[model samples]
Target: MFMRAGLTIGEFSQITHLSVKMLRRYHEVGLLEPDRVDESTGYRYYSTAQVPNAQVIHRFRELDMPVREIKAILATPEPEARSALISEHLRRLERQLDTTRAAVTSLRRLLGPASPPLQVELRTSAAQSTAAVQAMVDQEEILRWYDGAMTELDAALADACLSQSGPPGGLYDNALFTHERGSATVYVPVTATAPAIGRVRPFVVPAAELAVTVHHGPHDDIDVTYGALGTYVAEHALAVAGPVRETYLVGPPDTADESAWRTEIGWPVFRTGIRVSG
Candidate 1:
């Protein structure tokens, strides 16, 4: 039956829908073997009867089954274990597919034009109940230290650095992007009624009149947005006195993508209202 329906590698590939490179790899891996090889040119020929098995291997690999796992299953020579291994791989792939779908949906939301440039809003924001981690952070080390500090807070407290208890914020003492590198504190609100955890207590970032702009997206390109907002403020003659702060209204874990983040950038300023320069 096999010799009666023998096929060349190209014909086998067309029938099985697996690439020639993949067929070669399967041969090398001992998952599948060519039924014949030309003695002179070393070309391979596969029997059409083997096409169904090749299709099965292709489907399993597409589902992200590890090559080693596939080899083991093929070598097991048992009906039960092979079926069980396939089931386990299916469950894992389903979970990853769901996560990928969520990310796609979130990206779609973020792809829209950024919300209209911050309309200047003037209001005295009251001081907030704060939990902060202070550290000397170089630009390269900032993200690492932040992750560790955030994890520490997560393990120890109920509300975290980005979670809203009052107003979530961070105070940068020096510019990290321009490489002036210095200390910074990532702050978040705590439960007012509850007692402080260790040094995490009521810390104030000073209630002040701020010139704020709403940024709806990831923080990666936030500097451009900052420059625009700063230009707007400067044209209106506002002097930024203190550290610029970010109030995270939406975050990555809260949303599926980083692009879905919504942050309020507030530059503590002295000048207010639309002023005309004479």
Candidate 2:
């Protein structure tokens, strides 16, 4: 009987580098059924031809591919359909890898010695008319929404032949940070407001006094600047209830080099007569 069955379960496990336990689980899941079974002892056996399939499953599992997805890939007869499924999983893995790298970079910066104190200033901004896009958005989706909104604003300005008077900016409600969802606005200041287009519309940006600090480099560590600025406001100024404003003086839209980026983070405040400390 052993001579008739191609390989015992243990033999197949050794050749495929898969554990006997995993093979059993795969068999139970109908992922890889045995080629033959002994009627008397109910022993499982696999053919030598199944070695390649087991190895392929092992490689896919190493890449963290789901068993279900692997099954789908195997079941699909069309080469293109199978390739598409694998390609999509690879893309998802790439996105996860990118997020992990960014988190690692941020962690390194945070664990290093404290940097010099942030230089904060108090300034008054006057009311200005602009073309803007506003929406209620989730925190996780803000970046995507911002990119789309800014692109539309730029095209609308170009179509109307209007020149930007200042850098593009955003106003984010406090609830956005506290509750992870809230009203957000992205705007480009222009000499004259352009006609409403899609989510973009002619609007006025209200004036307010702000305690501002410039955050240099990529936005990955921008929260550090926001924290420092908030500390200064709590100590020296009267904090007002309003949306937080960010001015993208030099950003991805301006340069691909993140080190060259400059963002101005402003907290709404009422100026106290106290002088700014370095």
Candidate 3:
């Protein structure tokens, strides 16, 4: 019966879809020790009963799970703990997948196809009333800081009994995008600047005649919107010479829904009429 219950490491590896080396490593790590070792020849042997456990471990690792996590999972006696571990890993993977999809979608629309227009025309943006928050954000830390900043901005807006017109915009200095951390103001232009915060100030965005259009989704696709705005400006013979401002019309404050988000993108431009909309 004992002989019938045993299988050589090679046979176990073949059935479990794991390599001999991996089995040896698993044994070394105390994850799966062999059933027996030869005293004189030093050959390793495994029990056929261990096949299912080895298979489960192999499947979890294939899913990119950490070995330590798999170890903890294998130590569990309850089905629920194993299931919870798998669910946590699935959550992480889903977030990674979402970020990847956004990136892929963005690149595909970077349109080198027909080309962008040569120049954009100048336009007046009216003195727009907005509830905004200003901050001397460190450039290197801006993205890292945006979530918290946006939270504060929203809280302030709520206290003021106001609403946003679009997604928030960042007035990023040249350095913030390319070099060290720098100052930025995350703003939502309202009918009036809400009462101020400590140096987190408030200001009315003086409107200019803006070349504007509705961007219908997340900032992940913002470059596409920029391309659209760029083409619009060039087709009309305009040159952009000012900060890019985005006014969020619908987003977190009204709802945490992405589909309902809308932004009006504005680029100041001046044109010579010798424009090429690429």
Candidate 4:
């Protein structure tokens, strides 16, 4: 019997830098099959032409691509389709990287010296009518809901020929934070009456006295500011049971730079001349 013209599995592994064990696992998963298999000895042989293919698989694995996805990429014949698959995976990796960066930033801020005292002011907000969208949203879905609601509010105002009188704001029920799900209302204040359309409705925001603080930069670390403001309210003022308010003073609509974004976080409060004793 004549042996096939190919490098043995060991030689292929040495050239590709993929461990022999990994090569066997990849084969088992149908990710990267050997060019030839000796029927009698069960020995695997790879062609020199498959070197680039093995290298490509190694790179994808390093990127944490799933074996199934790598197999799909290899099986795809069209260049455009293969590129699309890779691009989609790259996008997912980018999102994961962003999340990791944000978490690191938060951890560093927490571990560092105590942040400067929060600049909080007591202010009264007057009742106003606006175009709004309200929904019961889970904490994990808050960002998605906020974006959709804001867009809907914008479109509703435009369709009604109404001019926005103030920056966009949101009211988040305490249950949302405490229980991970609750009512959420986002609105765009308008001078004229807003007509009801779709999820957008004419809603009136009641007046309230708030202990407000400005959270600079991105929303990722906004919770730190929230904690500071809560502490301040607990120490010097009386907190009222009401939905928290957030006004986007300068946001994504105004600038692509997240560092320039400023959000006003308002905690409902009632000031009595008495400070709480701990």
Q: Which number leads on lDDT?
A: 4
Q: For model 4, how many clashes?
A: 0
Model 2 vs. true fold: TM: 0.80
lDDT per model vs. reference: 0.71, 0.89, 0.70, 0.89
- Stretches of candidate 4 off by over 4 Å are 1-5, 14-17, 48-56, 71-88, 235-237, 275-278
For residues 67-117, what per-residue lDDT tens digits would candidate 1 score against the true structure? Answer: 888887777778998888878888677757655665675556457677564
- Candidate 1 segments whose C-alpha is farther than 4 A from its true place: 1-118, 159-164, 177-179, 193-202, 275-278
Each candidate: how many clashes? 0, 0, 37, 0
Task: Report the lDDT tens digits of candidate 3 across residue range 1-278.
Answer: 34453678899899998999999999999888889887887788888778888988898888888888889998988999889988999877776676688778788766447543423334566665555555566643555477676777777877888776655675554455446655566776555557676434566566555666667667667667777776677666664555566666766667677777877777766535443332
User: For model 2, where is the 10-residue window of minimal lDDT?
Assistant: 1-10
Q: Per-prediction RMSD in angstroms?
A: 8.5, 3.4, 6.1, 3.6
lDDT score of residue 93 within candidate 1: 77
Question: 159, model 2: CA deviation in Å?
Answer: 3.6
Would you list the rank order by TM-score, best first?
2, 4, 3, 1
TM-score of each: 0.51, 0.80, 0.57, 0.80
Residue by residue across 1-278, what tens digits does model 4's lDDT show? 99666999999999999999999998898888999998999999999999999999999999999988998999999999999999989977886776777677778888999887778878889998988899999987787788888888888887888999999899999999899999999999899888889999889999998888999999877887888889889877579899999999999999999999999999999967653332
Report model 1's TM-score to 2 decimal places: 0.51
Candidate 4: residue 125 Cα off by (Å): 2.5
Quote the lDDT for 272 in model 2: 78
- Inter-residue clash pairs, candidate 1: none
> Which whole-number lDDT from 0 to 100 does residue 20 have in model 2?
95
